[model samples]
Target: MLTRILPPPGPARLLTVITMVMSLGQGLWMAINAVYAVTVVRLTPGELGISLGVAAAIVLLSSIPLGHLADRAGPRTVQMWSFLALGPLTAALLFVNGFWSYLIVSSVQAIAYRAGNNARKAMIAGLVPKADRVGVLAYVRAAQNVSVAIGACLAGLALAAGSVPGYRAAVLFTALTFLVTGALTAMEAPVPPVPASAGAAFAVLRDVPFLMFTALDGLLVTHALLLDVVLPLWVLQHTDAPRWMSAAILLVNTAFVVAFQVRAARGTGEPKAAAWASLQGAGCVSVACVVFALSDGASLVPACLLLVAGALVQALGEVRQAAGSWTIAFELAPDHAQGQYQGTYKMGGDIGKMFAPALFAWLVLGHGALGWIVLALAYTGLGAAMPVVVARGARMRSGVREVAAAGN
Candidate 1:
């Protein structure tokens, strides 16, 4: 059942675990950051949204350049220092009490955040066998989920300490998590790529299939944002649902991610991966629609039924989606330029988020659940179109060598 915190503890395995631990710690604070902003920092939803937006902006702007640097100086160079600075930068947030203070730290964090995530993915792609990529990513998903679970448990304990703002405890614990983990990352040896240069980084994105994969992923991410923004809004406004419902939903997803993410990441063979992802994507869209639709439909009995059904189905899709995305991205990404691909690929999601929340919010405001149904349909449509993209990618892969051969 893959119970260890990370894969067997060789140097690579050890380094991966440390990175996951640090990421999980930071991710936990992120999981609860909104709570800190609203409850302790006293930012309105709009204010917090703006803070998130600013953080997202830094990533969007810096991704290519940072990726280029990673490509040029080697990923280890960028990753080591990014981690070093992150320790103190994130730790300082403990002293922050206001909106502006939080904003500054969050922005800095966005810059540092991409390093660990991209480098790890790039490193994994470099080490693991081609067919085993999904299996490894699945294991990775499970490990990171464990870290998140630990972080959440710690948050609960800190809150129990009472009287002090949760922000102080949360920030300190999270910062230590980053600092300690980042320090551990420094222990690993560099895994530099062939023909390491900025030109190689940009050259990779020029590939037709890779860009299509990136675009499709960006669309999927943009669609998925509905769960984060709209689902909770429906619960809070349209029903007597407790605030804990959001926590419940998150926990449900996390449990699934921890449990099944590996299996999901094992996404069927390339031939079937496309159709499977489409079906999974469609299910995700349908269930999300039905659940939110039920909450707004004004019947507790039906809402409960719909909510349970949706969450279960959605969980399945989450597994499929993660595996499918990783399989495709890793396969299509340029080998010598995997780090750049990872950064640019991740950067796509951050860019999508910039527009998604505001647009989805506007859509809901204009039409209510009617608006949601429209979006649900739109997402489903995109889900439907994914197979075509997948097929095209397959054909393109056939046309290209899928490798950077010996000098031009």
Candidate 2:
């Protein structure tokens, strides 16, 4: 049973453990950070919003450069240093008494977090064979979900206490997890640095087709905001379901992802298979939107049922989309520059995340059911377009290779 749950005693296992540890901290922080900022730290909502926006901008701008650094200076070393830095930065959050201090701490924390994540991706690509990358990552994701759930439960205890000391303890616990994960990260097998070449530092920027695909994938990834940002508010404001149902919806999604992400990732090692999975995932999410729309005017029982059904569909979509996206991100990039390429790829998701909450709030809270219909249409369009984008990217790469061969 343990073997099935964990990778054998190797770099894969080490990475999985690192993910679990890191996710535990993330779960704790995510659950209480907003409340802490508002009530404990005494920052207004606008200040909190500004701080998050700044952090997002930092992530978008810093990811590629940090990834490039990983490619040049070995992924393991870069990742270890990033994690070490993150421990201190996250610990600084306890000292954030005002808007400026919070902004500075959060932005720096975001940079360290982004750098470590990009290096981890590069390390995975180096350690795991292409055929097994997605499969291994799937297991890691499941482990992450499980760890995060446990961390959230721990956070719940702190929330129940509702004391400043309790909140501080949660932050301190999260900081300790980062420090432990950093120590664990140092144990992974080292991946040698990719030698840098003149004029090739930003080659991923020239890959227009890949950029387009990334953009589309980013848009589709907004399905996350639907679940995290929009759904709870929708249930509370527009539907007849009890307030507790919001938490139940998230529990349902978490259970499904933990149970089936690896199963959904199967057969998606190649680009074509991955593309199909993306489309399927998108369709499911779109259908979920329609179901959610139906819940708007439903009675209590039917509304709860519809929300649960929507969460299940959304979870399936989330798993399949994640599997496909990981495979495509790994398979499409040149192995020599996986760090930079992955960083560039990550920027797309950052953009989506930066805009999604506001966009979703307007659509769901402002416009209600019609907003869901528009979201459904948008998701379907993006998913349907992925196959063409992937094909175009492949063709462009093939052409570039042929040209280089002729020139040689």
Alpha-carbon lDDT, every model = 0.69, 0.89
Question: Model 2: what TM-score?
Answer: 0.96
Candidate 1, lDDT over the whole model: 0.69
Score candidate 1 by TM-score against the native: 0.85
lDDT of 2 by residue, 137-230 (tens): 9889888888899899999999999999999999899989988888988888899999876239988888888898789888888898887789
Worst 10 residues of 2 by lDDT: 1-10
In model 1, which runs have C-alpha deviations exceeding 4 angstroms? 1-16, 31-49, 94-103, 157-166, 196-201, 240-243, 269-275, 364-369, 402-408
Best by TM-score: 2
Please, what is the TM-score per model? 0.85, 0.96
Residue 163 shift from truth in candidate 2, angstroms: 1.3
Alpha carbon lDDT at 396, candidate 1:
68
For model 1, give the 10-residue run with minimal summed lDDT.
399-408
Q: Per-residue lDDT of 45-147 in model 1, one digit per residue for the tens? A: 9989899888877788777667666666666666777777777887776667788998998888878878766776666766677776666666777777777
